[model samples]
Target: MLSSLALALSCLLIISPNTSAAPNSVPAAGQSIPLIRRAQPERTVAEWESWAKNEREALTAKYGGNIEKRSTGTNLMTNQNADSSYFGTVAIGTPPISFNVILDTGSSDLWVADQACTTGCSKVQLFNDLSSSTFHNLSEPFSIQYGSGAAVGTLGQDVVQMAGFSVPNQIFGAVTQASSGLLNPPVSGLLGLGWQSIASSKASPFWQTLASSGLWTDPVMAFQLTRFVNATNVNTEEPGGSFTMGFLNSSLYTGTIDYQALPTTPSYWILPMKSLTVQGNSITIPSGSSSYSAIDTGTTLVGGPSSIIQSIFAQIPGSQPGTGSWQGYWTYPCGTAVNVAISFGGPSWPISPADFQLTKLTSSQCVGAFFELNTGGSAPNWIIGDTFLKNVYSVFRFTPAAVGFAALSNTAVAMNGVNAPAPSPTIGSVSASATAGTGGGSNAASHRWSVSCASLVGGIVVAVGAAWM
Candidate 1:
């Protein structure tokens, strides 16, 4: 989901953070960091649907609706929790205070709870600027809204180290107050990997700063997002996979990488998607439908236009639109293998059926991974998330402004096993019916895009909160 906050807050006032110092040392290219996958306990189908609703609402607020034209904008799965986010540990300040933060490619901004955050920072580790001799306060305010909650703070600069690489004078928000929903224990903040143009803070993201400082050998970052829903053993937390900077790891993928050129003046990793197919049948996108798609690593499920999503489920037997709280969603037979794929001016990459079945709903019905989205205007119509990303090795290249995808290697595929024949109660289930539409399309209409600006500073703000959406 591209945060509407990016677009709505583009004209935010800016106070440049000092970037005078060089890194302690230039690390070699291809530095890899292991990602931690945190899974919440399994919830009922209704609970999962509710979570999905919130996720979509947050996205709607971020991208949908009539965004204020003041200025700029920009821009998981489960469990076995039905909602999992990937994290990588990064240290801020002089002596290096480490915090496990989400590696989000959706928006551009890096932030963590400040020592002064008394509102919802009690449980998580806070960044104590007083202890770090190198910390500098930019004296600029910052605030960002998320679907679950919002965080408010001030801009600050310090040394940031991750995976053996150190970037000095990195500007980030030191949150003073936040909603409890944005605070997931042990998961302190987020590291934005999107373009600087869409950054609410109007500051270079950590990765871009590292590249500009001549520390990166190739100016590329790649991800191998692992899965666990179909694993033989389920756990609350597990190894999500790898995040490599400066170079791509050949061992994680096979064959030539299919690189899709991004739009000029790109914000998110927006690209042209030629078509979408379900069970090898191409689904027709309406005439006014958006042709551009955003390869968002920060989102959980795949979201498309409402009518297009409805067309997708129509091809599956026994498929039905969600009724009450599950509106804007579709469900099908749990045992049905729904093969889906999408092309980006190259060979169509197939999505595993296991990932398509988000979670089981009943003895016979299972929720599909695709959801409906209506962004009102010409934003990217398709928002691709982990449901399709986990099947490939994704690389975000800066120079050419392109996103590359390659087939996952056997070793990478073995991390998550195939989906079981039927639903497992221990996995998760909810109460729902595959009947005629009741609260279906109407619920989606209710979400017809809106923006919620939680807080702002110096005319600039960026989301450094949770990446659960």
Candidate 2:
């Protein structure tokens, strides 16, 4: 496809042990970056729709299905320092309490320090500290992790105010062993916009909390990231974008919102597959198999059963099947012509070359780059990251909502020009991040327009405009 471009979370959890992880061993290749850069595009509502529609519903009804509906939101985009990695703070309660937070859609489980686990978890940002005069920790601290290694903390009652809404005495994550990166993001904690397990807790969560509290009649959340690439004058804190959560308000976008159904939630958006194609050619991958695919905003990369990934990679010319530790992830001759495509409960959609490129750790030589994830996984697990999200306009809904997913016309990204990866560390090995590289904090410039071309099966060469209307 492109390069072994890995989503920050995929690289971290698969590699880290604190969070539940697949066994580790020698690493293999990752996704690749696109060899060519296409002309950019001017984004509009219409174009985004075509890229993420159901062109294969009748064909893949057995694979799974898609959904779209109006939803709501609550800001979890933690405010950051204007120039540093630290998260800005807010005072709370009579004693004054402060904590860092990272806005995450991949994994859920909002952990904050609990009053009880005072020992081992000190390194982590604690919530119960009464240093701020306004701080207060409730007697109950509850913590949960879904295999992505997690720590425990007391569940206290307190109000967390951000953006607009204030979640009062909301039970959040006070994860242990992860105050600083390595399962703990640099921020004090994380927000679960991604709904795999209602984030951390399987039950009582922000959705339940809000719905129960009657703050919002419906739970709907959608993200609008800035563009990739950076611009010097950036304000990561209030620097740019904003996500809205509440019942879908038509006033948000000037375009139309598509709705899809999400019948089950073993995986939040489990849509069936119609076919698998390489360079536009149909391949013999199982489409009707009992195995289903789940769309996760929490997971940065798409992981699935070994057979599925193996088949896709095997078909790639010159690509080889990695063993032991590295599987599912793929690699091919850097210059050799490569074209990878995907099907999300519908027709095969090609994976962009940029999506394939894992990372160009080196500009001089591209050897260090990895191809998404290789082995780390055991059974059929698909974690779709930027490769997929960039291709579709995704929206998430929580609890008793009629819509399971919301489809946007386009993910028009506008970056103020800031990169999410921490600046190079000079003093010491920077504390490890739970995930590597930033998730799609910014949308691809391609949203404005796609340029350039590559020959696919039958030499059916195709090229996209830098901008689509």
Candidate 3:
């Protein structure tokens, strides 16, 4: 298998053994999970704001967006103010009060101010205990932290409604010490759908509640984001708002939404990739590497090992020369035409060159930006990004549920999971000085790389073409 990377700040994942679940496990089909939650908590606005700050930085550089926030007409005690543009206001905790929230996928962890919350909760907005007629408290108290940010709140449920999908008794975090929602979002809370979490820090019983109780037939949840601009840098109130846990009911993607069989990888759904084929050669790497890639809606760039990446770049003629590091980021030529074919699975199904390259970020030359991910971490793999998803239909069946993938290349081998290709040797760390397509097929070691040059799937092999989506 090849390498893959995962990057999302506000990570949230909910899974549990059926027998070990809460006693109040109402049949999921009977009602929504959040609607039937156990209890609620109290929260302060400042606690959540701090969390937003750290999560925002980890998210912005890799993806895009701003974390800074402006207050409404009133402060915390008397009046609650929020702009629906980029901010979302929601209740949190047992005796739930409202706080600002950011709809994020980069990471998942539901947190809000709590009665036990002290300094952090007081830093920003705090859910006023006096309001919310449906507020109730549960005995379960939880704590969650990311990187360094942390929050502690009692478990509870709230009636959260958004995008027409509602959980009347939706669980709330009600963090007593929320760091992600401190100032910028002096609003309410966050909805986490990424692949990380604070052990078990939630009161809103969101997706976990629904999935655990079998309320929802499908375990898979998806997001569709429509970037919009308005009076404030807010994404709220926009016609095409951010949607979650559902499909984007649209005409463009109306057809058999093929599913690619998937495997479990601890948390996220993983698509196993037997090998990576570049051009007509198989790029070789060390054995026992991360054999699969993750299909993350929250991640933008694909991250992977340096050696494997350099192997692919060996095919992009003239793409070398950016070996220099810019604040740890590699820089390349100003105007090198980006093109190449990346094949996963085996040799049968191959990714076209168009799916392998990304457009330039700035007006200057954009070299290998799509596959540009931070591999500085402890993993060795690659992320199949826009170059891959735009052409194929990807379905991430949730955990304990099967995951799958399928190609829509409009070719004979379109459905081929990818044929076996030769493994190549590791060259060196990717560098700007090395040009694309510079290295040939010869290897210094016994291990060799085979290129899956021709593809019969689409009848139009990745010979080379103008930039296409």
Candidate 4:
């Protein structure tokens, strides 16, 4: 059964053992996996704002307040502070025990609760390494520092199967100890879909491993995030969307696919954003802004510079800055149709008004999906999440190291009642100079970065850490 993480972040996958395919055999030219969009229970505007505030605060603290410090020369770490709404399935081991895991593009390490984790993992499925004939203990310690706690365990290798594909001897964490509320029922761990450069474990991610084994026609993956906030059905769990591997699904998108080149030494699927506008008026980007954006599927909301977020909200009449627990957030008239659009050196894509409205306050005002996030001078200025992603079809290509976006097909758009105009013809490439300052930091190779999962999974704000050996 599908389950939702109250305030947690990232995507999930359900794995079923596929023993038919050989260990290193390619299954098909293109494979598609169904995704389940876990609908968050309706919340008051105050609660939503509070979550947003805590998320930003946790992220700021994770990077030492100023993101530039972490980017000075240190390897940029994977830290997330957002909510997850989409999930799929996957399996590990020889006989393959199935588990629900988050598919996070922002991170690059795969981990699951070990059968020995009796603390916070009680409610979730555990990986029984001893039961798998192919399991091999690496004896290396593995730890993931969360906002409120950590998942500590050891490294091991076993066959991991997903979407009819199998990668033998995949390295992953087997968490023997976990803090409270880290892994909930139906959501056991995470499947990082990023490059190995950012992986804390220094192991290649699942997709990268598959690509290296010659398992696909194209080294790319695409996502189409479904919406439920304003849908008529409004169920707790529904067919969220589709994740396509190897080849693009033409039926899921329309028009031409616009591609943007990543950084010279890219880690995340980050690219330069050309422009942003609200209600037809352009919002001036602050000078000295990194102007780069990480296309993160794990993040639930769109986070950017405080000034730019405030400017966008200012365009809507009756918009007001949130106060107290809702600080760093803004609210607008519930009836207002906020039309926002963004570009990445190509045709501008519009975000649906329904997707932009987060939650209702006082029956008149509604919280917005965009919030204040100042990532200092050198880090990515924006974390583009499902808020904007749900409006279009996104593609992450590894061969040429670029990200692509296309307008959603009419069928996909109808799911959320989104009525957007056709995009204009594609434009020339945008300058990548704005992203030059990113990916820097002190060589903290000996130090492991810790993130607060408390803010990410639940509403709490607690500090947690673990030793890596």
Candidate 5:
């Protein structure tokens, strides 16, 4: 649960003197930025799924079991108007400015938007340090806090520029003051990739200042989000995927990539979950360190533990629990062939039941991005978002930092917007008896649902219009 929310590879590469190569030591091969998903005309897709279920009910009431909690001193959370979901495009000092951030692996700083902020950061583009000549005023001073607001600011350094590569100095955060969920943020701040011991600008965490300044030939980082699964302008913004830093693009992913090793406690990408089967039931969760498991690309859904998500729909057929602003939401009947699976030590993966349906709350019904996070008692922390990470092709390595997952890369299954198909690692060991709803008509015998964890826990605010990518 980092509060700020949130490469390099190959092709003739070799540079390890503990990094920082570029003074002519060669290296260079790493760059590619497109990552688009913009749409946020003042928030929709059910207001970004009701602000990601109100930031997972304010991180289960502010760190209850406190899983992976790291703070180094300052903390930030800024989910202001959120909605850009996944963004890209860097460029910083010496006249660069460009911006458009938000690529969080769930927290580590790299802020922006500081021409002395002025107020609610006026929708994007700022950072002017008196028109830059490689700005560097590290006058130190900071503060970040968000689930909806706060930014303050100080610290600085320059030269970042992406795609065309270049690192130069790169320390970040400039803000001046912000909040209002980052006033106009659909991207213009946030580029963390996590771990620098939970950085709040303690500095050296912009991909470890781009691999100690050598700028990347392979410290590895990869992602291929896409999935707008169009139900018409699924929010709009466009582009969708691509953001490789060091190198992994073996055409986006398929077969062998797996990687995992993260929990030496660096912060956020933490893993080791090992099991979660549904439809073949294996639910019994809630374990140590708040139940480890984090993988959050800026979280958009998929949570856990409310008694193993109410014993995973009490084990699926016509699932339920949803009413009056859909309290704790959950619904079914669209094509209910539910399967769900998760494991992190390898094999078990599976997901796709039309990616767990999440929307259609009428005209034949549907809803369910899997939320239930009552970690309030702690030791049950789980987040894994992008509704199962857009079906996979992830990879986030920093030397041996680790976090990988593959399959989904025939250009991300042809930019899924319902092109569907491609994400079948299949897994079903035991729970499968609740399937019906094959082609609509007869409204599948009028779909009525219910599954109370005491009527879906609390902070109820359901809304899954779709494409909260």
Candidate 6:
């Protein structure tokens, strides 16, 4: 799922109801639902590092190379810009009709915004499959192409929901020509969680059809994501971060997760890494092969291989290079102390230079979430994102397709002890200033500010996408 806890973090829809969850059925497999993730509006760290260097150069120019080179059904994962991107609220078809979508594990299918969209669409909520009655259309004809925009649309089915979790019919996509960076506000469509193969309608997303329709006994999917510290950092009135589905919440983590093994051939949750340090040393990247990485909670910043991020920003210190819309970016200088780590084979995980420092741009420059990416030649992947996964505690599973990690939920024992402090500087006063504004829509008041985005899905409509294998 994703982590890296502090940088305006916000999204906690924790639903731990083991029983008592009927009303529309489905919610038995270790029940867990949470939705309220925000962190890309509250800018100041130099305007959220210039909108994360234009969303990492529009996701390395639309999904840097070998992005699972799709063709089976149609490819997807196109974006125009949704700064930091993350949204919730599902409900689709039948008597239901809610819509807020955009969860993405880096490309799949699911869709929304139909009513024959209107130029650059985004007036929000739409998808009237003839006013639903368990809609089912299937005229097929979907499309997706992003680097800045695109979405065709046709497919159908319906009755999907979330939280209380239902899953009748399913399928998804309705749009009808979109591309205004997907309406660019809160989020209007998306929820792929990768690996149904790359779904272009190859199907099987929507929680793998509720984990094979058994209603999720465990197909696995977990994420944490909460790292706010500015605009009045509100730690937790309750749900701070969660997306668990089908189980594995050992009380939200703390040590012994590690796990690994996963490489079903470019299907996303990739692994292998084994390098990239800075204050603790290491920084190789001569690459000839074996240097993978892809965790990607639908990426936001961390991409890689522009010469291994210019050799880890030439070992940070005054770090520079960026220019004009953050040229290739690497800009650091704001409160430099830097530690940064990332091994993923055994030891070293660290990463908390306040999650790779970014934002703050004049009082002495700032910006460094490491983004260079152009890996087209393959091998040098990376991606990572969520500023090093909000500080660990991921999962992903799927019957041993693996990808785990631990250490969050109160520093997982001071990060396994060895002098952990670090992580500090959750961005405080680079003179504070302000002047970013433009937050428009979605965040719906922090989803009940303090927790409870209320989800038990009585109004089903689960579209889901990502089909390849």
Q: Best lDDT goes to which candidate?
A: 1
> Candidate 3's error at 199, in angstroms?
4.6
Q: Order of all candidates by TM-score, from best down to worst? A: 1, 4, 2, 3, 6, 5
Q: Write the per-residue lDDT of candidate 2 for residues 1-469, one digit (tens) a residue.
A: 3345565535533433233323454344442222334887976777666544445444456567542222233342322333112222332333435555444444444555444453344555555545434334444434443323344554443455443344544445444343222232334455544443333343234433443344553556655433232134444444323455555534333344444444454233445554666555666655442344444433333554556655655655666543333332455655543466655543345554544544332242111111232222221234444445433445555554322332333323333244554322111111111111111111111111111111121221111110000
**Residue range 1-469, candidate 1, lDDT tens digits:** 5488774444232322432224554423333222334898989999999899778767878886542211100001122233356666777887887786777787677889988887877777899999999998888777765544666788887877766566567778888887755656666777878877666567777777655444555667888877876665555556676777667778889998899888657687887778789998998764322677778776667777788899999899899987665666788999899999988888889999988987777788998878776544445677777788888999898887799999999887775644432121111111111111111010101111122222321121122222443
lDDT of 1 at 324: 60
- Summed over model 6, clashes come to 31
| Per-residue lDDT value at 401 in model 6 | 76
Window of ten residues with lowest summed lDDT in model 1: 435-444
Question: What TM-score, over all chains together, does every model reach?
Answer: 0.71, 0.55, 0.47, 0.70, 0.29, 0.30
lDDT of 5 by residue, 88-185 (tens): 65667776766766667766667777877877777677778888897878676766543334566777777765554555566777887775445344
Ranking by lDDT: 1, 4, 5, 6, 2, 3
Tens digit of per-residue lDDT, candidate 4, span 310-414 = 889989999998775556668999989999999887888899898788777668888887877655334467778778888889988878888999999977666
Residue 55's lDDT within candidate 2 is 50
Runs in model 1 deviating more than 4 A are 1-83, 286-289, 376-378, 417-466
Worst 10 residues of 5 by lDDT: 440-449
> How does residue 457 of candidate 5 score in lDDT?
24
Off by over 4 Å in 5: 1-75, 80-103, 106-122, 135-168, 171-205, 210-259, 262-276, 279-296, 299-315, 319-341, 346-366, 370-397, 404-469
Assess candidate 5 and give its TM-score to the true structure.
Answer: 0.29
Which residue ranges in model 6 land beyond 4 Å of their true spot?
A: 1-111, 121-128, 135-157, 160-166, 169-179, 183-188, 192-214, 221-276, 279-296, 303-321, 331-346, 349-394, 397-443, 446-469
After superposition on all C-alphas, the RMSD of every candidate to the true structure, in Å, is: 24.0, 27.1, 25.9, 23.4, 27.2, 27.3
Please report how far candidate 5 places residue 285 from its true position, in Å: 20
The whole-model C-alpha lDDT of candidate 6 against the native structure comes to: 0.56
Query: Candidate 6 lDDT, tens digit per residue, 209-280?
Result: 555444454567677655542213232221224566666667657667887777555466778787768887
